[model samples]
Target: MNDVQIRTFQVPGARLHYEVRGTGPLLLMIPGAPADAGALAGLAACLSDRYTVVTYDQRGLSRSVLTEPPADQDVAVFSDDAHRLLAALGDEPAYVLGNSGGALTALDLAARHPERVRALVVHEPPLPELLPDRERWRAVFQDVYDTYRDQGAGMAMGRFIATVEGDGAAPPAMPDPSQMPPEALEMMGRIQGNLDHFLAHVLLPVLRFEPDIAALRSGPVPVTVGVGAASGDGVPALSARVLAERLGVEPLVFPGDHQGLATDAATGAEIIHKTLA
Candidate 1:
C-alpha cells in the first residue's frame, strides 16, 4: 500500500478537496448522496497501489465550497462540477466510477461529454428512466420533498434514510436536528437543499432524458453496469439489470447494498479494478 496524499485545489471560485493515491491511469470516484470523499477512503486505499485513485468532496459537500449559489442543482450542474474537477486535475478521458445519484451524474457526463470520459462504471443508478413505474417513483420522490418542506429536514431525512435502508414502513427516530454534530448537520442541510433542487429541476427532466442505450452499447468507451449482490431484487439491482439490458451487456455484481462500495470498500475496489483492468 502507498501513503495517500490529501490535497485541496481551487477551482476558480470554489475550493475543491481531493485525495490522490497510487500511480497509474487516473480513476476518478464520484460519491453518492449523503456521503463525501471519505466514503471512498477505503476503496481508494485499496486501489492506491495500482491505480491513480482520485476521490473528492463534491461541491457543497464537506470540504468543497460552493462559490456561487448553484445556478441549477440538476444533474447537468453535477456533471459540470465533475468536468471541472477532472480538467483541474489535468486528467482527460479517464475512467469514471459513480454510484446511485453519482451514477446519474456520470451517465449524463458520459453522454454529454464523451470525450472527457474514457470509460464509465455505473453502479445501480436510481434513475427513473429505468423504472417500470416512473410515475410512482416520481410520486415517492415528491412525497419525500413535500415531507421535507412541510415537516422539516430532520423528519424528512429520517424517512428518506429509512426508505433507502429498506425500511419504508415509517420514518425512523432520527437524531435531533438541533443536536446533530455540526458537520453531520451541515451535510444533511446540503442534502436537503439538493433534494429540493432535484425534485424541482432534475427529476422530470431526467425522466425525459432518454439514455442513449445504443450509444452506450456501441460507444468507443468501455462501459460497465454493476449492482450490489446484497441489493437483492430491489430497485438498485433492478435498475442495473435494466441498464445492462438496454446496453446489450451483462450486469456485474459487487459486494453489498447501495453503499456497498463504501461498506465493503476493499472488495468493491478489487472488483472494480478487475473490471477496468
Candidate 2:
C-alpha cells in the first residue's frame, strides 16, 4: 500500500484518521464494533489493485479523537462523516462496503444521500431492530453493558462476543483474559477503554435505531446485503436476512462470520469485488 495516503477529517469536535489507496473509483469500507481503520488494512490492500479503498477510525475510537466529552453515537453522525469523506476525496457516487456497524452507517448514508452512493454492499450488520425477535437480542446486548458495570471488561466483552456470535462460541482463540498474556492483557486494556464508549455511546443507540424502510425502499442506490456463511445462526446474520427482506431482496452469503471483513479479507474482498462488478 505504498500508494496509500493517510489524512484527517475535521468534524465539529473530532478529528478522523482515514486512509486512501488505489487508483480506480472510490470504494469506501466501514468497520464495526471496536475495530479501527487498521482492522481493514489487509482487506484494503487486497482491493487496492481494483479500487481506491478508503477506511477510517470512526470518531471517539482509535485515532479518530474527540475534542470534547462523548456525545452522539447516532448512526447519522457516522453517516455524515462518511459523506464528508467522500466529497473531500473528490469522489461522488462512490461504491461503498460497510461491515457490521459500518454497514449500518452505509445504509444511513445511502438512504439520506442517494446521489453520493453508486452502489452499496453491506455485510452482516447487527441490526436487532429489524429482526422479529428484536427484544430478545436487545436484552442480550444490554446484558453486556451490565456485565461491564458489575463484573469487568473481560467478562463483558467475552459475553458480548458470544452473544452476537451465538452457538456458545467466541474468545477462546485469543490468550485467556484470566491468563494475562502480554498481548492479551494489552488488548484487554484497550477494550476496557473502548467498552464504555461502545456501550453507552455506540452500541446502545445503534441497537435502538430504526432504519427508515420507506426511505430505503424508494432510494435509487443499488444495495447488496450479505451475511457471513459461518454466522448462519448469529444475530448479525439473521439481522442481515431481515434487512434484505425488508428491502425486497435476499441477503447474499459471504465468506466468514460477523467479523469476516477483518479476518477473511482476501476472500471477502474478492466476493465484494464481484458484487460491485
Candidate 3:
C-alpha cells in the first residue's frame, strides 16, 4: 500500500474532507448515498497501489460543511463540488467513478463541464428518466419520503432499502420506527435529507436534467455505464441499461446490486479499472 493522506480543503461554498492514496493518475470515487466515505474505503485500498485514489465526504456529510445556503439538492451542486475538488487537488480531466446518485452527479459534470472529466464509469445510476414509467418511480420515492416525515426515519429507511432491493411486489415489512437505534436513526436522517433534496430539486426536474444525449454522443470523453450483476431485474439495473442505450454504449456488469461496490470494493475497483482502461 502506498502512503495515504486524509486532508481537508475549502471548496467554493463548502469545506470538504478527502482521502488520497498512491501516486498515479487521479481517480475520483464519488459515493452514492450520504453515507460516510468509509463506504468506499475498501475499493480505495484496492486501487491505491495503481492510482491516486481520491474519495471525499460530500457537503452535509462527515467533515464536509455546507457553507452555501441550503439550495435544492440538485446535480448541479454536486457537479460543482466535483469541479471544486478537482481544482483544489490541481487535477483536471481525471477519471471519475460514481455509484447511484453519485453516478447521476458524474453524468451531470461530464455533460455540463466536459473538460473536468477524462473518462466516466457510472455504476447503476438511479435515473428515472431512463425508465419506461418514470412517474411510477417518483411516486415510490415520494411514498418513502412521506413515510419518513410521518412515521419517522427507521420505518422510512427500512422501506426504502427493501424497495431498492426487493422485487416490485408489495413493500416489505418496515422496522418499528419507535425502536430504531440511535446510530440507525442518524444514518436514516442523512439518507432522508438527501432524498428530500433530490425529490425537491433533481427528481422533480426530470425534464430539465435529462442528459443531452446528443451532446454526449458528440463529446470525445469515453463513458461507461455499469450495472451490478446481483441487482436483479430492478430499477437500478434497468436504468443502467436504458442509460447505456441512450448513450449508444453497451452496459457493463459490476459485482453486486446498488450497494455492491460498497460490499465488494476490491472486485468493484478491479471492474471499474478495467472499464476505465
Identify the leading candidate in terms of TM-score. Answer: 2
Model 1: number of backbone collisions: 0
lDDT of 3 by residue, 1-277 (tens): 7466979888767788788988778999887655656667778889988889998877656567678875555667777888888877765589998877678778887887788889999888777666888787778777766776788656766666655665764443456778976755665566555554443344434323456677677887789999988777666677889989998899988876777886788888888888878
CA displacement after TM-score superposition, residue 103 of candidate 3 (Å):
0.5
Q: Candidate 2: list runs displaced more than 4 Å.
A: 170-172, 175-193
lDDT of each candidate versus the true structure: 0.73, 0.82, 0.74
- Name every residue pair that clashes in candidate 2: none
Q: What is the C-alpha RMSD of each candidate to the true structure, in Å?
A: 4.2, 3.1, 4.3
lDDT of 1 by residue, 1-277 (tens): 5677878877644677788888988888888764677667778888888888888876666677768664435667677878887887774578999877778778877877788888889998766657787677667667766787788655665655554555343433457888866745766665555554444444444444446676666667778998877775545566778888888888898887777886798889888988888
How many clashes does each candidate structure show, in the order listed? 0, 0, 0
lDDT winner, 2 or 3? 2
lDDT of 2 at 85: 84
List of clashing residue pairs for candidate 3: none
Give me the runs in candidate 1 sitting further than 4 Å from their true place: 9-13, 162-210
List the candidates' TM-scores in order: 0.82, 0.90, 0.84
Span of ten consecutive residues with least summed lDDT in model 2: 183-192
CA error at residue 52 for candidate 1, angstroms: 0.9
Write one digit per residue (lDDT tens) for candidate 2, span 34-122: 87776677789999998988998888887788988998588988989889888888846899988888888999999998888999999
